[model samples]
Target: MIAVLIILVSCCCFIFSTWYTMYKNRNLPPGPTPLPLIGNLLNIERGALVNSLMTLWKQFGPVYTLYFGSKPVIVICGYEAFKEALVDQNDAFGARGETPALDPFAKSRRIIFTNGERWKLMRTFTFKTLKDFGFGKKSFEGKIQEETRCVMEELRRSQGQPMNPARCFSYAFVNVLCSVIFGERFEYSDKRFSKLIGIVDDIFHTMCSIWGQEKNDPSSPFTSENLLYVLHSLFMGASDTVSTTLRHALLIFLKYPDAEDKVREEIDRVIGRDRLPRMDDRLNMPYTQAVMHEVQRFSDIAPLNGPHMVTKDVQFRGYFIPKGTNIYPLLCTVHRDPTQFATPYKFNPNHFLDEKGQFKRNDAWMPFSAGKRMCPGEYMARMEFFIALTTILQNFTLSSEKEFTEDEVAPKLAGFLNFPIQYELSFIPR
Candidate 1:
């Protein structure tokens, strides 16, 4: 009898606490009412995180709050809200938010998850080091070209037989990253490398290197532990994000053979069969450029984007967001904003093409995201997208045994990382 009374009192206290907290945050941007313990967990449909958030965007308007447990997360959707928060008020919204799953392990140590002076110092060091090692410049072109050749050779060995290119794409992307950070590239067959890749894949389902050898200053952020975390950030970006994007690009081309043909035609005209596609050739190949941009927009990988935090309390879009409040700057909403794109849902390269058939920039198309938290590796990723896809098209035509529907080729829209459907493709030599 005493135990039952205690349990009843405990339940009452919990309900009161939850309601009081909600009442306190009443001035925050409004959304659906959250339950006591779970907050709005029931509001989200299982296996459709991006869709769920987007649906809320329509119902609650652009800037609104969604509770994850008792905590209020300010979700900024659409291109306008994104620009206003992430760009116009970047500093206030610049702090890294808690990635609950990663926080215990990462401990806000990595470049991607850290905030304040640590992030600034890490970014400066990494950018300079990677630049010195020729990441974003023409000097690095040879490394990418060589890695693409390795991929081409591997595909040729497939002998036009259908195979899942995911593993091959993973190897190529990791090798390019490994080469720069570790000063060595692993063969696709290397057992250790294969194991490492496998571990990375598993973690994405849930959630590199030695450049700091010369730093002697103990006060500097370039400690061995910090360097490892930096490498962790770089590896995670390359292994999953870049490789998944490549998979999406190939799958999209398979779905639209006509689009693939046009890219090939451009490749033949400027890049030709004699050599691997050069970054210089991108200027002359507008169609290819448009297609690459379209693929990114359509894929919408990292849709929710890495969570951010408000550094200080501020008014945005007529709502008050408190300091350290979690923020979800939805990249998915921006890429698919109807106001921004003519046909946002469909995979149309014309979203990036002008009347003159030249590639045009759309600020809404921010796969690397925008503002202070934008990807430091943007230049390298862009180079990979262009050079890798061009090289593949230059060497072979992509085809699939299974005819994928538009939905099949579309972004999975389920998890943190958007993945293309698992399908096999035959790379017929051109």
Candidate 2:
């Protein structure tokens, strides 16, 4: 009886401490009450981060707070909140938050995760280097198209069989940057290139393991450790995101063959089958562009988005956000904002199209995010999208081994990325 009494007393104290923390942060945007130790973990199920926050959005308004294992984060839902925080108050909300999941890959030094002076320097240098290397230019697009020609031979080897195309897609995209970064693109079967591909295959895990081993080493471009980090950043930026997006595009094509037909129709009409699709061809092929945009919107890619930290203690949307607090812009919310898209839930290319059938851009469509930390690979990714998808569709008509079902095309947001489930594709030569 005495032991039971002590247990109850301990529980009461834990509850009191939790309540005190909330009391101190009473001015924070309202959210579900957090429990001690677990915080709001029980409130949010794993793999359903976006849907769970979206449910709370209905009750808590666009901007609200939620605790993940005692770390309170301000969740910005919808376009207005995202614009207000990330755009209007860019500096105050500019710092990149330390993400425990990506700290291994980010190292708090690379362009993706670093904040303030480091972020500014890395971003500036990266942009300059990319521009120098012809990113977003016809030269870069031509380079990507060259790589695409190489992969097309590999895809043809499948001979209408159900095989995974992710490896070839990844190799092509990585090699495109390999030439720009390493000054020489490797053959697909080269031993050194193959090993490099292996490392990038599971890059997030690889970097997580190798993150700090280079810390004591001198800071120079020639350092082997630093070289690895640069390669890792490039792979993270180029390979995985683009490969996953292209793979998703194929899955979408299989699921909605009519969408595929529309893309092919647009491609054949403008570029024709004789020549490979080019970035210059986008203006004449609005339907293909819209379909590609829709594929990305439907994929949701980096759903939660990389976390951003508050640069200074500031009040936003009538809530007091302390400096250094983590902020998740909930970009998936804006991407699926009903007010922004006519059919937010469906995989409709019309969302990115205007009445006249030209590809129209939407403010809420931030697949690569916005503001200070927007993806540096946005232009390259776009080029790859047009080139890679058009090339694949140009040579092959994709179909799934199994019948198309909603569960098949729908994303399994089990972990960090919003990607489709693994399904084989029959890349039938067109």
Candidate 2: stretches off by over 4 Å: 1-11, 205-228
User: Tens-digit lDDT track for model 2 on 153-179?
Assistant: 998888889998877887888899988
Q: Return model 2's CA RMSD, one decimal.
A: 3.8
Q: How do the residues 137-254 of candidate 1 rate in per-residue lDDT, one tens digit apiece?
A: 6758888898999999999999999999888888888889888767888999999999988876666555513446556877567777777776676776777777889899998888
Q: Single out the weakest 10-residue window by summed lDDT for candidate 2.
A: 204-213
Task: Tally clashing residue pairs in candidate 2.
Answer: 0
Work out candidate 1's RMSD over C-alphas. 2.5
The C-alpha local distance difference test score for the whole of candidate 2 amounts to 0.80
Q: Estimate each model's TM-score.
A: 0.94, 0.90
* Pairs clashing within candidate 1: 208-231
- lDDT (C-alpha) at residue 418 in model 2: 71
- In lDDT terms, which candidate is top? 1
